[model samples]
Target: MSTPVYEKVALLGLGLIAGSIAWACRRDDVAGEIRGYARSAESRDKTRKLGFCDVVCDSAVEAVQDADLVVLAVPVGAMGPLAREIAPHLKPGCTVTDVGSVKRTVIEEVAPHIPEGVHFVPAHPMAGTEHSGPDAGFASLYDNRWCLIVPTPGTPEADVARLEAFWHRLGANTERMEADHHDLVCAVVSHIPHLIAYTMVGVADDLSKVSEKEVIKFSAAGFRDFTRIAASDPTMWRDVFLTNKEATIEMLGRFTEELFALQRAIRTGDGEQLHAYFTRTRAIRRGIL
Candidate 1:
């Protein structure tokens, strides 16, 4: 067999992203050994039982000790403390990356903690289902997905290329962007959608008790789709909203304005306004290509 792309990769947080990475690395021979750690003992055991990693450690520091590549796969809020804990134990030349949704906050929190010789490459994989946890991951999750690399201002070009290649080998298309811009773009495109889904589902739940069971039992596909997104990991979504507050709030304001305009068109029986609005949006999508 050919040599693995990496000697040993450490994963700090064996959730959906971490588990999917482990499976992909093993399938593509990207890493010789995968060491992983989760927040709880039950998760560690479940990872081991599922064959998610070669070794499971009890602590972040222990998991990352000799790893050539360390990927933090926890919630955004946990990145800083985990980075501080693992930095002291990281190998000198190891490359550390993350699969966070927001790039700016993570780089701010994680970059300063990395030691002198360690390389930090902040990345966000634009891929995931509403489901989470190790059980929810599969080897195919990263296949053909776009992974954005947001390197710091002074980061070396060679380091960035190497990290980009790493994601490519995992079956991802790579792009580079400024960390702050990435957060704002994701807020408008990804974050705001999830927030709207959550809101729509919440609205349904809070309706009059007269139709409570019928809401769930006779739900249509559109409402069901909102419910699925609303079921996403609460802790992760909470951190996402909390950490990326400004962008989300700004996007939400625009969203509400647009929604109110649509509502007005319906209330006033203005068919032409609704038709023109949807037509303009469809043209915008056609231009995306």
Candidate 2:
């Protein structure tokens, strides 16, 4: 067989991202051996049965031993503790990375625990489904997606490039970004949109005139899409909002301003203003397409 990206890779959580990474590595022949660990016994058992991991260890320490690359796939709130747990056991020259949504807070919390020799490169894979768990991951989840590699200052270029190459082999296009900039960009592109979706779903639920049955029975595409976004894992999103508070709040304030303008246009029967606004927004959507 040809050379793999890493001889031994360790996955620190058995959630959707981690499981998907393991399966992608297997599919691409990216790693010679994949070791996995999860705090939940059920998740560990499920991963073992899934056969994505060559070995599922009982502890994080065991899983990361001698690993050339270690991926922390836990929730953002849990990443710091997991990093501390695996720090001492990390192999020198190994690359440690995480798949958290927010980068600044993750770098702040997890960077200190990385030993002097181990390289801590924080990353966020811009790919996931509303579904989460060991069974929710597939090899193609990251295909054609962007994976931002937010390496800390002074980290060797070789290390960052190696990670970028690894992600490339996993079918993701990689881009290097700074921690703070990454957080701000994610806030605008992902965080605020999810927040809006949750709020819209909640508003529908709270409308007494519309019964839940009717809401579900006559759900339009807009509402259905909102429900899909709002159905994301609560704990992960909670951590994302909390950890990325400043950037999220800044963007949210801007969002509120735009919302008030739209509300005002509707109240005043300003069809021209509404049409102009929608036309511009539609162009933005077309750009995305």
Candidate 3:
């Protein structure tokens, strides 16, 4: 058999993304040994009981002791602290990656602490469900998804290609982009949509009293989908919005402008204008599919 892509891989967090990575890497034999660390004892116990890692470390530093690849799968807000904690323990020449949703702030927060000789390849796997925690993960989450690799200027070409191949083996289609650009695009496509879903669902909940339980009883699949997205781990989404502030704010600004226009169209009974706008959005969805 060919050698495994990574002899030893360490995962910083053991939530959905990290658990999915462990499952995928093991299933595909991408890494020989998987070491995992979680801050909470409960999480660490779950990681061990789930058999997600070859060895479970008590601390992030111990997790990266000899890992050739270290993936930080924590919330975006925790990236800096985790990076600082693991920097001293990362083996030289190791490739440290992340499965964060946002890129710009992560690069700034996590990159500085990476020691010399260690390579940092910031990546965002454009995949995941509304689920959180290890039990909610599956090996196929990354399958057929786009994994964006945002590389710094000085990263070695070979290392970049190797990491790209790693994600490919995990069943992801890989693309490279600038960190800032990745944040901007994700904020528009994923972040703002999630925010809107949460708001709409919350509004429905608030109106449930007037609806006399009809809203909950008669909710359709469309609203159900919104509830799923809105129900995603609050802490993770909170960190995402906080860490990727500029992009989220910019997208929110644009979203508010369109929302006002939509409200105006409704008040004025501008059916033609509304129809054209909806048609345009439908085309975009069709393109995505």
Q: Which one wins on TM-score? A: 2
Instruction: Indicate the worst ten consecutive residues by lDDT in candidate 2.
Output: 221-230
lDDT of each: 0.88, 0.92, 0.90
TM-score, cand. 2 vs. native: 0.98
Residue pairs in clash, model 3: none
Model 3, 2-33: lDDT tens digits are: 46789999998899999999999988899999
The reply for model 3, stretches above 4 Å from the true place, is 208-212
Tens digits of lDDT, candidate 2, 1-289:
5478999999998989998998899888999999999999999999989899999999999999999999999989999999988888899999999999999999999999998978888889999999888999999989999999998987998998999988998999998888889999999999999999899889989999999999999999878976797988999999999999999999999999998999999999999999999999999999995
Candidate 3 yields a Cα-based lDDT of 0.90
Candidate 3: C-alpha RMSD to true structure equals 1.4
Candidates sorted by TM-score, best first: 2, 3, 1
How far is 40's C-alpha from truth in model 2 (Å)? Answer: 0.8
The TM-score obtained by model 1 is 0.95
State how far residue 147 of model 2 sits from its true place (Å): 0.6
Residue 61's lDDT in candidate 3: 82
Report the C-alpha displacement of residue 115, candidate 3, in angstroms: 0.6
Count of backbone clashes for each model? 0, 0, 0
> Per-residue CA lDDT of candidate 1, range 1-289, in tens?
6467779999988888988899888878888899999998989989989997999999888899889999999999999999998888899988899999988789889999999888899999988888887778788888999999998876778878988877888889999999879999999978998988888878877888737788878899878866687888999999999989989998899989999999999999999999999999999979974
